[model samples]
Target: MKVKCPTCQNEVEWKPENKYKPFCSERCRLIDLGEWASESHVIKGESFNQQLTPQIDEFSEDLPPADEDFFKH
Candidate 1:
């Protein structure tokens, strides 16, 4: 089977041997990663922060209070 690379739109052979099957090459894969990392590519939906903020706020009071040594083990 063959499909277009999601990052470069180049034709790619879909096979287990192709490490970057969905991308044309490592460069294309990295480009896609950079886009997502920089927020250039975002899925359409309610922002995750927006969705979680209310839940977090509701539970904040139940969490143990933090201190300088909170994370110590």
Candidate 2:
């Protein structure tokens, strides 16, 4: 099977032998990585931090409060 590269739109062969299957070459793959690393590409959804904050807060509430005695033990 052949697919278009996500970075360059070049034709790519989809196979195990092709290290960069979705991309034409390593350069194109790295370009896509750079875009993601720079936040130029983003998934459409609620922010991950926002989603996790409530869960983290709920978990923290169940933990026992730290006391000065804890340090002494």
Candidate 3:
């Protein structure tokens, strides 16, 4: 199947034996990877809530105190 290059938009023929697959060559493939690594290609998804809710019980003030005696020894 023939397809246009996503970067340069040049029409290129696709071959199954080509390791790069859709991309015409290694350079084009690397350019695509670089874009992804640099976050130029964004994955669209649902947005998470900005406010973080505490998982632990608010009333429980039972955290163990740090041992300063260990360092002193």
Report the poorest 10 consecutive residues by lDDT, candidate 2. Answer: 59-68
| Candidate 1 local distance difference test against the native | 0.54
Question: Residue by residue across 35-68, what tens digits does model 1's lDDT show?
Answer: 5544554212334225343543322233333422
**Candidate 2's residue-wise lDDT over 6-51, tens digit each?**
9879889999999877898775765565354435532122442254
Q: State which candidate, 2 or 3, has the greater TM-score.
A: 2
Task: Report the Cα lDDT for residue 2, model 1.
Answer: 91
Clashing residue pair totals per candidate (backbone < 3 A):
0, 0, 0
lDDT of each: 0.54, 0.55, 0.46
Ranking by lDDT: 2, 1, 3
Model 3, span 1-73: residue lDDT tens:
7898775577778887876657776556545643544355421111111221243222122312342232234
Model 1 residue runs over 4 Å out of place are 41-73
Report clash pairs, candidate 3: none
- Model 2: residues >4 Å from true position, as ranges? 41-73
Stretches of candidate 3 off by over 4 Å are 40-73
lDDT of 2 at 73: 34
Per-residue error (Å), model 1, residue 2:
0.5
